[model samples]
Target: MQIEIVEVLDQERAMVAFNSPVGSAAGVWKGGQGLETGTHHVEFEIPDEVHSWSLVQPTHGAITGGGARGGDFVTVHGQVEGVGEDSVVTLRIGPDVIFVEMEDSVERLNQGDYVTFNSPTVEIYPYQT
Candidate 1:
């Protein structure tokens, strides 16, 4: 996805806006890569070991984070693609595929289940051509 780094918090953290077809989201970018103010192509991943999530009625996919929403946290709403070993799960949010590592097994969640969960951080890696 294409994201704009709106504010630089530090060398490895910044505030970014995700340009998504479904909905836009503002979040704190956490990665080893340094970023300046501007738009860049990048991919995101949930780096935390999530243990719980809430099942919600099917709704439009969206990403929300930062500021009043939650400091250094992100909320993602999407459909479950599948659950794998080691508590890793695949989720399809709009056109982006996000991989989440859960602290607890996600065997209870089946494919196509729409769920929402908050992660403490979302890491962005610049996409290389």
Candidate 2:
């Protein structure tokens, strides 16, 4: 779906918030994937992990297979630790842990629920404001 960049929270980490279609409330992904705040035409495979985030990969599970060095690391295969305010989803993958800021439009996730995203790429197009 087409989306607009709402806020650039962590440009260095590519953690920018995007405005959902509805408005006001925004969503964030693990990486920027070369996206900047403005108008962006994006095609994302919605994840069932409440957050419904997409990763910028060419093939599913190829980069995270060991060390391919892709910035899109949202494929956190583990149980959810908790859900905090602002829709931050915390999850655990073995000894490692991850946090995902979810889109308000997504469904809510429960604690201990299994979460994983196999989507390789979230196609993006940057538009000038």
Candidate 3:
């Protein structure tokens, strides 16, 4: 998905925002070279293990701040894309697929399950192609 790098937080991090078919979301930059403020095609990765998540009624997918963990944490709402044997769960969030590492086993998730959870970090990487 394409996102605007709204603010640079540090050498390797920035604040990113995007609007899509599912909804709008703003999250902290994760992986990638230091970027200038502009629009870029990127992929999102949740580096921290998501300890809490649950199936929810189908709703608009979004990434927002103010997670219960607080301090740069983010909340993500989306549908489960797939559960890998290695515990990495793919999430479909508003026209984008984000790879998330789950803290717990992903056995409970099924394809297309709508879910939401909080994570300490949401990383965005510049993508070419």
Question: TM-score of model 1 relative to the true fold?
Answer: 0.79
After superposition on all C-alphas, the RMSD of every candidate to the true structure, in Å, is 2.7, 14.0, 3.4
What is each predicted model's overall lDDT from 0 to 1?
0.71, 0.45, 0.71
Report the candidate with higher lDDT, 2 versus 3: 3
Looking at model 3, which ten-residue stretch has the lowest summed lDDT?
64-73
33-78: candidate 2 lDDT, tens digit per residue: 6656776654333234343543222321211311122344423344
lDDT of 3 by residue, 1-129 (tens): 877655454543455554434444556665556556777777777877788888899977787763222345677899998998778898888888888888665798999899999777666677677
- TM-score of predicted model 3? 0.76
Give candidate 2 misplaced runs (Cα > 4 Å): 1-74, 104-107, 118-129
Q: Write the per-residue lDDT of candidate 1 for residues 29-117, one digit (tens) a residue.
A: 65545567677777777777787888899876667775444456678888988888877788888777888886654777899989888
Question: What is residue 84's positional error in candidate 1, in angstroms?
Answer: 1.1
The stretch of ten residues in a row with the least summed lDDT in candidate 2 is 59-68
Candidate 3: C-alpha lDDT: 0.71
lDDT of 1 at 78: 86
